[model samples]
Target chain A: MKPLPRIVSVLSAALIIAAAIGFLDAAYLAAKYFTGGPIACSVLDGCDTVTKSAYAVPAGIPVAVLGVMFYASVLVLALVFRERRSVTIARLLAIAGAIGFLASVWLVSVQVFILDALCLYCILSAGSSTAIFILGIAVWRLAVARANASDAAGHDSTAGRLPAVGNK
Target chain B: MSKSSIAILGVVVLAAAGLVYLGIAADGGPAAGGQAAIMTAEDHVKGNREAMVVLVEYSDFQCPACAAYYPLVKKIAEDYANDVAIVYRHFPLQQHRQAVAAAQAAEAAANQGRFWEMHDMLFEHQGEWSGNANAAELFAGYAAAIGLDGDQYRRDVEASAGRDRAQEDFQSGRAAGVNATPTFFLNGQRIVGPQSYSEFAALLDEAIAQNR
Candidate 1:
């Protein structure tokens, strides 16, 4: 029931918000993709171009659906592990964040080089994923620092205990 | 911010700037060949026949974006009547159930020498028939309104040649790397989207100046 460390709380909060934003952005695109509706793009007037590009759907699956799944998983993980005193959650988040960031980079490049257009929703998802990745890194560092502090405290009874399964 | 955070920020900024630069650069340059061969004498063309600036559009009638660009396209054809020629090609997306039918209708109307009228009517009344279950019937009404023989128009709309003509346009668009409605090729250079008239005018003006 104890409150999480300041860094952990901040990072967890940031990650959750970012993931939520990513989920909404991707979900909206996916809905429009399936329903054959027009995408409203303000930043760049190429939402339709980018969404209708060959790269938009891979293996008969809309990329926006994959994005929705990715953001949903990250959001769940962040919520469940927010107050955990272990590095496992942070490491998992970092890995997921890295994957999302890399995917965003690839998709954005497709929009740029191949499609020659920009979609505001796609950009929003990319920006949110990038923010989550950065926060994940910070969270990982904080978890490592906490673990190190615990180790240096020796057998001190007041020191925080690491989860037995994720002690590594 | 931490040094690591600052470094991450710098990397992101660099990457974003690089992407923006690449996007702009990619949008430049003339589009590849093959489009010229696709245009036949039968294609629907508007404006000056000998215009230096030729704008080819691969569009879907049922596409909202295409509808949005309809007036702008008409304006471009009007404003640059002497300097530009606009060619229409069909690129119906599979997702829109009415797109192919609409394309066939347009082609059917073309069989009676009313392609442009039907084209304008379809786009102007897109909202009325976009999701209708009987789009073909709606198209028949449009044909009648445009003064075409309704019976012949209906028969042509259902004919294989009408479908074939639309398919031909789709194939040509695919070959030209058109993946979306309202994709424009200005002077054989690709420009995507229902972009503003000013943007199109600016590019057209530049191309005209360069050609001169």
Candidate 2:
């Protein structure tokens, strides 16, 4: 029932900011896809090759759409944890972050190895996704620490009492 | 999730949905709003010159990306010979010191019924004369190889006769919203440049089908 650690609140705020950036970057690309208008590739080097490639829109859905979904969930998850301070919420964020981090790794590899080109906007979204993963872990760790501290306090106060079994 | 958590999530979801809607609406989706002038008898066209599905490219010869796109465009011209009319216009950028000169060379070659040949040679060997100070001489060599009157080609280059034509294409390209090399407009609507032959073919096929 006690309030979660201050660090959790701080990290949740960080997650929200990171996720918002990722969301915006992804949203812009999705909009570009919907518009399907003139795409000017750089004269000598850059994004048009990557974006216009087949890999960019797998199954007719822009990869940015997937990014939007991931980041929006992160943004909402972080916001919820900030207000509710629920351990379940913290765990969810940590899981989401881990998934996002792995996905970014794969996305970057595609840009470098398979596509052999880097898109500035795609890189920006990747950075934000990585940030969300890190911040999520920080909040989840703090929540676990707080729960452990409270349990320790309870044990010291009630020396003869048996702890409840199952589900820690 | 608690009531407050659910409420916050719902609010954020609604906000994201609203943002996406605005993004799409603001972009106005794809519409046929090409400012590039329609190709006519004066324009340099290849393939079915009278076809309804015309693919016009505003391109710079010295640009590496345009060079990269050269082969792809060549393939498209061949594959869609019956359905698409391929038009190439000069969009020589100022930054590439020799872009205007290269465009001029093509124009000179055009006077001899060899513009596309010069266009192909320039792009195929872009790396050779890209920044060469003797670019005009290199172009003259191309003029000879393509079997043009070498003497007249030299005179055309020296007099800047081809420059006037390059300038017209440049002006029209600017009007058409071409700010980069290799900008393609299919049926007066801009379409993303394809990365490969199949991608371009697919686009051409779609356009051809629509034209019918």
Cα RMSD for candidates in order: 11.4, 8.5
Relative to the true structure, how large is the alpha-carbon lDDT of every model? 0.74, 0.75
lDDT by residue (tens digit), candidate 1, B5-102: 34543553354446445444544334653674334687799998677878888888876667778898899999999998789988777656787899
Q: What is the lDDT of residue A18 in candidate 1?
A: 87
How do the residues A55-152 of candidate 1 rate in per-residue lDDT, one tens digit apiece? Answer: 99899889988988898788767765564545777788889999999999999998766654467789899999999899888888877777777667
CAPRI-style quality class for the chain A–B interface of candidate 1: incorrect
TM-score of 2: 0.56
Q: How close is candidate 1 to the true structure, as a TM-score?
A: 0.57
In order, what DockQ does each candidate have? 0.07, 0.18
Docking class of 2: incorrect
**Steric clash count of candidate 2:** 0
Which sections of candidate 2 miss by over 4 Å? A1-5, A24-54, A57-62, A155-168, B1-11, B26-35, B38-55, B59-72, B75-174, B179-182, B185-212
lDDT tens readout by residue for model 2, B77-113? 8877888899988887665678888888888888888
- lDDT by residue (A1-168, candidate 2, tens digit) is 344445565787788778877887787777666666434444332445566667888898778889888888888878767765666788899999999899889888987666544677788988998898888888777776666666777633423222222213
Each model's iRMS: 10.5, 6.2
- Best candidate, lDDT-wise? 2
